[model samples]
Target: MRAAVYRGVNDVRVETVPVPAIGPDEVLIRVAACGICGTDLKKIHTGSHSAPRIFGHETAGTIAAVGERVQGFSVGDRVMVFHHIPCGHCYYCRKKTFAQCEVYKKVGCTAGFEPSGGGFAEYVRVMDWIVRRGLVKIPDGVPFEQAAFVEPVNTCFKAVRNLALEPDETVLVIGQGPIGILLASLAAQTGAKVLTSDLFPERHRIAAEFGLRHPIDAGKEDVVAVAHAASEGRGADAVILAVGGNALIKTAMNAARPGGRVLLFAQTQHGDAVIDPADICMEEKSLIGSYSASEEIQDEGAALVFDGYRNGFDLTRLVSHRFSLEDAVAAIELASNPGPDSMKIFIEPNLAQV
Candidate 1:
């Protein structure tokens, strides 16, 4: 088998490697489709994690082997797998903060090296706990590419629900990338008037399809002004910062009205962001952050993806490009430096087939 092994900073190569061995309680899945995530690119470029690991978590595939201890799953089962599953008994789990759970934070799936995400490889060993709780079987007609979105949608839906949006309010979402579009769409579904801002006109065109008529070209227009204008000069009731970079924190804050909410949906990386305390203290605005997916919303997220698939939302349409596992490096480059047309980049290990 061949896996894209991360050797060092900004280095990944497709090298022949042995298929991962699984424990009695584990399951082996042959990779079908894996999406390149921003977090994966960040880890690869920053060397945040040790090298010699395969990193890819947005994965969907057919089961190649099932452990003796595994139940309700067979060798030919098709599933969308999650790399992390909370212990469900820990302090954090009890509090419903699953991402912070000690057991949940540990990476449970791997290709050949340490237990990092192994979806970039030909096959991955899914630990027993995840096999029991984190894996969702793909329905008969849904494609693997669409099934792969279940995890990401969980994260996005988590953020939207946390915002506690109102149907009649106005919301501004910064950045019109895949995640941004998902955020805006979800917000609009709540009956809220959603405004999306992006420098790329192509992305705004994509946003328009979601019924987002007020697209703010941030590069050429005053996003804050437009957001205010849409809200009768009071600014948007809420603003979700879907793109990373500490610099956007201020812009998101400024786009929201006094006493409004600013949800930081991106800012996953640890760093310092400059902000004025006056914005929160004097203006009474709330700045909040949401990270990862919530187990409580897993079923809802999966249903949303499957239903969206059944509808014309066609989440897979966000996938703009596909690359074979052998050209994983090129896939990373394109995703890292997205053009106006690029949205979601996929790595189809079996691209030659379906």
Candidate 2:
């Protein structure tokens, strides 16, 4: 099997590796489509997250082989894999903070090294825990490309659930990347007036197509002022920082209303971010950080993804380019490049089928 192994910073190679063998309670998935995520780029660029890692978490495929003990799944069944599932009895899990769970910290599913997701390969071994609790069956009509979106959409759904959005409130979503656009769309569904902020005109234009009423270009206009005017001088009722840059945190805080909530949907890696605690305390504003998805929300998220596609979400528009597994490096390069046109890039492990 050919797998794109992460060697080091800015280095990824497609090399022939032994096909992964499934355990008695596991299953083997023949990879179909894997999405190149922002986290993968961050790991490659910053060296904050290292290599010799197979780092694709958003993936969809067909079951190539099912382990002896595996049930309700068989060869040729379409599926989407989630690499992490929390132990529901843990302290963090009990508090609904699944990402913080000890079991969740250790990746449960993989094709190779470090238990990081290995969807870049032609085959991945879905571990027993995940097979029993995390794997989702893709409906017959849904395409693999769309099913690959389940994991990412799950993460955004978790953030939306945390927001507890009010019907009459307004939401300002910073950054109009794939995840940002999804956030805007979901926030709009909650009856909130959605305002999208991004430097790229294409992204803002796409936000309009996603039902965002107000799209502001942060590069040319003042985001804080636009948000203020949209909310009748009170500023946005809530702000979601979908971009991970340190500077965006401050912008999100400033754009939110006095008693509003600010959700940090990204910024997973640690860094010094300058923020004023006084504003949070005095204004009675709350700053919350959301990371990863949970088993509790996975079913709902998957249902939403299926429903979104059936109801004309046009998620395929988010995918701007597709590359084969052999061109995995090129895919990563395109994803890393900050461009107005590039949104989501997909790597088809089974290029022959596509």
Score residue 294 of candidate 2 by CA lDDT.
73
Listed in order, each prediction's TM-score against the native is 0.98, 0.97
Q: For residue 32, what is the lDDT in candidate 2?
A: 92
Model 1 ranges with Cα > 4 A deviation: none
What digit string (tens of lDDT, one per residue) describes model 1 on residues 160-269?
A: 99889999899999999999998999999899999999999999888787677889998999999899999999988999999988998999999899999999987878
Candidate 2 residue runs with Cα over 4 Å from true position = 352-354
The lDDT of model 1 is 0.91
Q: Give the alpha carbon lDDT tens digit for every residue of 311-330 in model 2.
A: 87867778988889988888
Q: List the residue pairs that clash in candidate 2.
A: none
Q: In candidate 1, residue 148 scores what lDDT?
A: 95
* For model 2, the run of ten residues with the poorest summed lDDT: 345-354
